[model samples]
Target chain A: MDFWSNFLINLVQGLTTTLQILVISIPLSIITGFILGFARVYGNKIIFYISTGISTTFRGLPLIVTLLILFFGLADLKIYLSPFWASILGFTLCGGSYISEYVKGAIQSIEQGQAEAARALGMNKLQEIIYIILPQTLIRALPGVSNEIIYMIQYSSLSFVIGVKEIFSVAKTFNSLYFRSIEIFTTVAFVYLLLIAIATLVFKIIENKLKIT
Target chain B: MISDTILNVVDLHKKYGDSIALDGVSFRVRKGETKVIIGPNGSGKTTLLKCLNLLVKPDKGRIWLGNIEITDPRININKIRRKIGFVFQDFNLFHHLTVLNNVMIGLVKVRKLKKHQAYKKAVDALSTVGLDNTLYHKYPAQLSGGQKQRVAIARALAMDPVIMLYDEPTSSLDPQFVNEVLQVIRKLAKNGVTSIIVTHQIDFALEIADEIIVMHKGRIIESGRPTELLSNPQNILTKKILIRNFRTLR
Candidate 1:
């Protein structure tokens, strides 16, 4: 009974940490993704080269390696970052790289006439992007972006590695204290499954509302 | 009488790698005149229309709209493009937007009209093409080919452009639907909007065009009143192609 109570408390703490990271990281990654995506598609030589390089580097590295480098190497430089911040930076970089490709592909799939038609209507380049290009791209990219969001939620359990008290971290602490690894780890996995199921349900609701086929 | 010179092209040239699409193409279109360009494949009629809108920049020579020279590469192209409407063979309406929104986009974004004002103009444009009631709320996929083409016209019309360009507008439509789109173009021509059409519909061109140009190998081989050119062919290539393709109508 004492072990059971400790498991519940640790589980709650882990859920809280997971929620906090998602709340901070999702919006930041989306904004960064959109900017980099647009730069890759329409920017001139310098911006295109820089954005491509950054996206490629992030995409190539393993998530574990990225987290280790940021947490350990940066700590030695006296640029100490909290585990929360380090996890967020690592997740955001990976999310941005994946989301940027989604955006770039969506933008490219639009018909060339859409842009020409906008220009013929007197829209300059910037106005064309805002009023015509971006709206259409967003709708087309929603499915791909939604998939990325799901991936982000699942992989966010990795935040526990750097000592953040995320869901998995709480499961680890509960197991060590109670010596009931099966019960605690099974509970942790079930919580993650529940989180993912909820995320998928919410996305389905949005898809219905938007009439996205 | 409408002015005799609304648009002029002189010695225009365009090349794509080894192939020359337009070589020394020149013509003058009067204000309110409906000019038709007829040619076999690869004769550069489509290329000329693309140049007028600066979609494909010309390599040499000049294009003039009244006294304004449009050939200067550094000019504000958006301003020039705004004055002309282009209807493509494939319709090219935004599939994601409703017919109303597609028409309203140009008005709101380019003309800087308020949302209400843009919507009003789009409604008016749709009504002109006789598609206002059924299509305003629907996406392009819901409409038939004829309805979609009319919406494309409405989208162009909402810009309130001075001239309109049609590149084989009826070519992509079903036989039954083709006349409906042609009727819309005929109505616009009667309303005195300057128009340049590149088409293979010889009978329709003959009925509507004020002047007709016959092109061969990137050159205007014959140009005159439609009746004059269609009745008597001066060039051997024009005579041969017309006899082969249009002898039944003649």
Candidate 2:
């Protein structure tokens, strides 16, 4: 009975930490991703090369390596960031790379004629992007972006490595304190599954409402 | 004479890599004239029209519309493009937007009209093309070939351009749907809008075009009023092509 109650408390704490990371990381990653994506698409050769390099570099490196490098490197700069912030930044960097490709591909998939038609209608470049291009790109990119969000949710478990008391970290703590590894780990796994299921349902509703394929 | 020249292309030359698409192509489209360009495949008819609209930049020569010379690299192409309308062989309507919104997009975003005013103009344009009743809320995919082409026409007309360019507009439509689009073009011509059309429909061109230009190998082989040129073939290419193909129409 005591083991069951302890497991419940740790699982709840883990769920709270997971939710907190998601709430901050997902939106920040999206905004940064979109901006970098547009830069990759329309920017000059130099800008395109630089952004592509950054995105590819982060995407190629392992997530734990990136997290360790950032945590240690930033500490060396004498600007010590919290474990939560470090993990957030690491995940965002990784997420931004994938998200940029999604956005770039979505923008490119739009018909060239659409832009031509917009130009023929007297829209300047900026107006053309905002009114015609962006709306269409957003609709087309929803599935890819949603997939990225789900990946981010799963990967937020990596926050445990940097000593951020995220779901897995809380689980680990409960196991060490109470020697209830199986119960705590199982509960944590179920909570993660529930979070993902809920998110998928919400996003699916939005996708259907928007009529995005 | 000066004001009659609505669009004038002088020695326009455009090359893609090593291949010359438009080699010294020149023409004058007077106000309210419906000119048809007919040619075998690989001629520069479509490229010529794209140059006039600044869609394809010319490698040499100049294009003049009214008093504005459009060859200056720093000049605003979008402003000049606004005055010209282009329709493609494939009806390039925004499939995502409703027919009404497709027409209204240019009016609201480019022309900066209020939403109410843009909607009114969109309705007026649709009505002009006789599609006001069937497609106010329908998407392009829901429309037939004829309806889709009409929506494309409505989209261009919503901008109220001074001259319209049609690049084989009816070439992609089914035989039954072709007449509906041609009829709309005839109506536009009758209303005194200058139009330059590239088409393979010899009979339809005979009925609607004031002047017919026969192009072969990137140059105009024969050009005159349709009655004069079709009645008397001057070049071997024109003779062979028209004699071989247009006997039924003739």
Candidate 3:
């Protein structure tokens, strides 16, 4: 009943931490995805297989499993990362693997003639990828990338399992102190709904504005 | 004095598994000459154009574009490739880019020209293909096949290639749309642009080619002026293919 007075500050703080994780993870995921996908398609056999193996390993594992391994396994190797950084690393690895598939698909979906024309024009391999291939890949991969972004928003809550004081973690505190399961979860549900709404709207605008000619 | 030789290929050989595509092919084209290659389907016509740009690597060959040995592993190929423009049958314009950017890409990216300079050259190339300013902003999907093909030609020509190679440029066009493309090639030939065109057009070949090279199975069966080849009938495959084509048109 007095939820705002008691829990509003922590809820907002949790949301801010969740967003911080997102900002760091999303860009990292995209760059990793592009590099992995490009390597898989065009790199020499060794690099291509390495990228393939890494992508497969990450994509095969569940996100929570990855988080646990990153968080705990690192300590065994005499490395340490805070729960925040661990979740960011885990989520990025997971997102990058999924996004890499999208990128590879986009690259492959493009007609081979496109690259041939670019090369025939005397553009080198790097120039071809930058001008002819990368632009089209971004456009083609938009829908897939945005879908991953949405998945990321929901999965950001998984950070709570790593002792991250993110959205669900804040909600858990409120649920326990208030002894009001229905109200606490309802508010949490609304927060998630609102996040999804904003994510969907932003991606829709981008996809419409930037769809391939 | 500039060497009259614009392109020279020496004993080019290529195969895909068991099938040989180009079998010991050799030829030379002079500056300002138009050489048309007439071949049946799957006779390595496209492969030959692709090989010229190193898109399809040959098993054995030496290709010289002027003094530059394109086949040499040491040379920077991108520099060599820029001087040799290639147009594909499918009009492989970048579908995501505007018709203008399609032309400007090589200029901006490969030539590293400033945007304004690239735009000016791109427009000039498009205008040469009879694509006016109005169509510059259009996408490939927005244009007719003829227009897309012209845009493709513009994209290639904007590079200012020393020699142009067309891979069955008109093969994908409708009967009604064929002349517009052929007409562009005709004008280019008349303007003394050195070019090698691979096509099924016997009529266009006779009209425009200074030398027509007929390929059969996988080798150059005959290479001569249209008048001489038609009059003398040297190779049976050349005679058969040309005669059949002429008969269909009439």
> What DockQ does each listed candidate score?
0.61, 0.58, 0.79
lDDT of 1 at A159: 81
Model 3: pairs clashing at backbone N, Cα or C within 3 Å: none
Kindly report which residue stretches of model 1 are placed more than 4 angstroms away from their true locations once superposed: B1-3, B248-250
Per-residue CA lDDT of model 1 for B1-250, tens digit only, reads 2257988898999999999999999888888999999999899998888899888889998988777788887778888887889898888887778889989988877778999999999999999998958668898878889998999998888888888999899989999999889999999999998999999888888889999888877789898887777679898876775667677676
Q: For model 3, how big is the CA root-mean-square deviation?
A: 1.7
- For each prediction, how big is the interface RMSD? 2.0, 2.2, 1.1
lDDT of 2: 0.84
lDDT of 3 by residue, A119-176 (tens): 8888878888998899889989989998998899899998888899997899998888
Spell out the clash pairs found in candidate 2.
none
lDDT scores of the candidates, listed in order: 0.86, 0.84, 0.89
- Deviation in Å, model 1, residue A206 alpha carbon: 2.7
Candidate 3 structure, TM-score to reference = 0.96
Error of 2 at B234 (Å): 1.3
Question: Highest TM-score, which number?
Answer: 3
> What TM-scores do the predictions have?
0.95, 0.96, 0.96
- lDDT per residue, candidate 2, A11-86, as tens digits? 6777787788889989888887887888899889999998899899989998888888778778998878888888
The residue-level lDDT of candidate 1 at A211 comes to: 64
lDDT of candidate 1 over A175-211, digit per residue (tens):
7777788888888889888888998888778776666
